[model samples]
Target: MKQTNYYLFDWMDFDESLSKDESLWKAYTSTEVKAVDGDIHITVPYQKQVLQEDMLADTDVPQRDYILILRAYGDSIVRMFTSMVDDEMKDTGSYMLELDKALTHKPLSVEFADNVYTIKDNDGRTRARIDITPYNTEWWSDLQPGPQPTIHLTVYPDGNLAKGVELSDDHFSPPRYDALPIGFCLTEGKPDRATVSFKCEADECFVGTGERFRKMDLSGQTFYLKNQDGQGVNNRRAYKNIPFYMSSRMYGVFYHTSDYCRLSLADHSSRSVQFRNDRATIDTFIIGGETPERILFHYRQLTGFPPMLPIWSFGIWMSRMTYFSADEVDEICDRLRAEHYPCDVIHLDTGWFRTDWLCEWKFNPERFPNPERFLKRLSDNGYKVSLWQLPYVANGAEQIEETKANKYISTPTGGWENAAGTSGASNFSTLDYAGTIDFTSEKATEWYKGLLKNLLDMGVKCIKTDFGENIHMDATYESMTPEQLNNIYSLLYQKAAYEVTKDVTGDGIVWARAAWAGCQRYPLHWGGDSESSWAGLAGSLKGGLHFGLSGFAFWSHDVPGFHSEPDFMNSVIDPKVYMRWTQFGVFSSHMRYHGSHKREPWYYPTIAEDIKKWWRLRYRLLPYIIEESRIATESGWPMIQALLMHHPEDKTVWHIDDEYYFGRKFLVCPVMNGNDRRDIYLPEGEWVNFFTGEHFEGGKWYRNVEVPLDEMPVFCRPGTEIKVYDEKVDSTDDIDWQKVKTLFIE
Candidate 1:
């Protein structure tokens, strides 16, 4: 067994609270407070402690005073900052765009009494409190065994009470008095890390750690916030990682930083949710609300809300790994229209550039002769084009020399062959000797955006921003460390592409694969590469659910799956799996059919008719999808909502992951396998089957219900009305909203 090092954490003593007995941990003692520009600032001098171990003597040296600042936004949100070494605290990345505007909410009541500072609202309810009373260590020498008195911050939301304790009328006390406080960790006499620990109930559940592929509930799990190619949907690593999570305790925490972070949601100790930021300052926004929806509203307000997507962007997109020529794209479009298949966008992936997978921002002259005419012809027929590109320059590629000469590509700190800097210029598969485009530089951003602008001028409606998760974490950038810039690189890259496309074509949409907190403003993002298997389909659903919970409004996954076992050893997807995945895709916020194989419905003749049936249903439900998506963007909710988002009070719904609400009306349960039986749990209402007209009461379990492959378990709430466009059309452009009809279910 590997030995655990307790000293890595500044607060974790060898015997938990044993530091209180020996006074071996240094804590802050508040000295002065000042109010400046609607913010409270405090100076806290460190009270030095004597160390008993010689190994830790170096870290016990005296340090400067810590600066603690607190600001309130309305009644529900409180921003907290603990600064070390006078670091200028700033939002260095694109994480928070409307942070300044969010401070215009109603003022909060602030008070400090006997070393405890509290902030309340007009209702005289405590929203946040900071307890900094120094502890009398002698009392903990076996005379009094209680929680140690250290500086800590706690946010109070409505209906939060201590477990196994009831409130009395005389004197009110908060529950769970035995959790650690927020503080900094000293390394070699300098604070190098900041940690925030919150009290956790035994039944407390957490969600939304950014596109997680595991179980729905994030209880007893530790996650790292670093963007990496998830490779497959079955592991912990993901392309999108956000340092934000909401608890069933009716509160959420957004650790505001671009650096690497570690979140332990009661995985190390069952009593606390520990968050560690690898930086000198602990800057966070502690949001309290009455429900998870309210919490998400504040989170999106602090960050930016997702912009409304173009109406055509909601239509079905058809794509594959590589469409090698203009003839291939033409053939697919022709076949879809001939078969009366409804699709609005045709995406050309990897093969639009001069060389396949080598992106120089130019269409292949030989393969795509008269590109402007071709794009115009496609546009005339009510079809849009989306091209794929990444922010990487191959060594022998045409544009590498120009980019390197102009310093648009990121190299080593001093040069490409600097000492211990070979990883920055390493080869990536067939794209040998690659270099990452530095989005941090303003000149480079315009240069790259110029390339994308030219494509949009030729009628490319959208740009697929891909492969941003592979940035070297140790490379140097324009003004920030790689640790602070790698995860946010996804945001910068996609923002540039989305803005340029919207500027030229009037549609701000990108088929992005990587994301951080504020990437939702870019309109749409999709799940990364997934394997062609049953587990892959299940994992993709879980990923999308968690992504929505993380404050994203639009999300989609590759239909069926992206690749197969043994690296595309079998090109053909299983027919049943294709049919089942097609059912899942129709109800998504945006639908796209893409994989290693041909994703056209005609490929599987046995199930071709069934595939067409589901596709038509998607068109019929387009009216509901558009309204729900608009509501989601405005209300800061996800179009594809997990059951827990609406039923957080129900303990049974916390563990149910496979079931979800497609919109306000329909409950979609995807069939993942060939099995004819599955269990479905409905929460607290009457549900009517959308297909079979069967009714089932909620608040109970229905076990082993028989279902056929042709039908999924789709149910709608009682007395729900859904608008449907029942007219036959080959694309969304041909449908008129005035001809739509409504279906009322009861």
Candidate 2:
């Protein structure tokens, strides 16, 4: 085929058959290979490589740090040489080669600084840098004939340091299905603006990262990173920020650097993917394992792990946008107890303050008559209160002026222009965390923590921390740039909030929105501003499932849509929809019945009975849900699991998004369409229906199963156990563990 030699320190020349070792190099055949200005050009998939300028003439050549990149159609390995002599061009000094590929494969030679190295990738276990040589060599070996193709490079050879060679080969290794060669792929157009493309395997599906959206599969969708105000789950502006996602069938991939990057999947003519940013080289790592559980383990090893949540926050939470008066809240709690409907944490939304000024941290005296008495009454009734607050400070508020004077606010010049809406209408402002008391600054974090500590000491058990999606790219921090701080702002804010609450109460809980990669350390995030419709219910489930796959263990949503105000029995807002949504909500990590309209069970006359039934069901399943949360805190596994996570080899489970395995034991198939029957695919196991006690064999798809409006199709995997609690319980405090019923599926 082709032959090439590399001279290292005028001592060694390496030659191999390119056809025999397919793992090392890859070659593509086409009639379009041409030379332009001494550069090789190929236009099939679109790639070009050439040596433009030589820097060896300068005295800095020996001390300069150089990076050599090789792009091939399949897998390829790279080797580096140090020092070259004119006569000993075949061999001389030490050479170091780094093997970069997804599969476990070793290069021919590896030389460490201290000694010559050898590596072996046997049985998928990589053992690298086995020292083979004690000192460096400086002599070249005679070139031998080989069946494979090769390329050669000689720096300062014949006084020309930049010249290199490329050879043709008749034999080269074919590309692997899962392991793509570490090289550049074509974007099929002019390279003015860079684009990324990738191939989507016929049976494969991708999941994880980005904000929660309406569509279950993002196979053909185009996504952008710039933040906007598109509110609903289906629409664009994603509040939560996460740049890492895991593919269910293959390895979990993460782009480590915080740069503007784009991913295209099966969109081009060849269905190839191209990931590009302004940076020269892409910094990425692949976590490989056959199962989703092992993949998550490696993922958490790279990122930080999630922390444990307190036991009390596991029960039912009640929230509404307009829970104005303290007496009204007490009356509702009394009614819940009287009607045997379980309730734990009661959330007071925006109206809790007098002037609707956020972050004021004051109760409306008229509506809340006596703050201490109201809190004491709720505490006496075994319910905690969660107050809603955001990071924003109103312009005219006292805190705003104080913060500005203290340099806690972002400087005017460093702020990004608010182009989304009118200045007065848009709730947008930058908090400079660098020189100022912004979340990015240590001083600002302490300042916000002090505020939260004060609230926690005032008998508030939970804080519903909202907002944080739209952080300006120009905002400053001490050591980080604005773009770097954008996704991280929410996590830092939540950390400050958590620290403050924990300092005061010894235990803290926050219901926050907008998160990033490692934000799973903070518990309880909610889906924002869903409309009050049947479609919104489906959207909530889809969003929650998507979040669960992305490493978020705890998630919640408004039960009946936070923005709808229609009659409960209308076609779009039927009682069946409310009941079904409630069933799904209760199974989540932290259950909350919240909406713009009154979301209490008794508010809807048509669905009142159904709500009561589902409320009791939630109470009964509290033990299982709480135990699952504890497991998630310890293991980094999500409370809600995709089937593929539990079974990676079963290809059928990879794309089944509509149905998800709640926790580990229960498989929940939510009815997305307005029908009493839904189809679900079971993965290689015997399953017992939780509601009907019907047995179904797995490893196949089941269709048109009858499930009533008041019932959710929940099944337990074979050889699993679930614990059920008391149906009439108001709190989890004094529940008898011995009295719990354990269901064992075989």
Task: Name the top lDDT candidate.
Answer: 1
Per-model lDDT: 0.76, 0.56
| Model 1's TM-score against the true structure | 0.90
lDDT of 2: 0.56
Clash numbers, per candidate: 0, 30
TM-score of each: 0.90, 0.73
State the lDDT of candidate 1 residue by residue for 255-303, as single tens digits.
8877888887877666778777777677777777777778888888888
Error of 2 at 374 (Å): 1.7
After TM-score superposition, the amount by which residue 533's alpha carbon in candidate 1 deviates from its true location, in angstroms, is: 1.2
Residue-level lDDT for 174 in candidate 2: 16
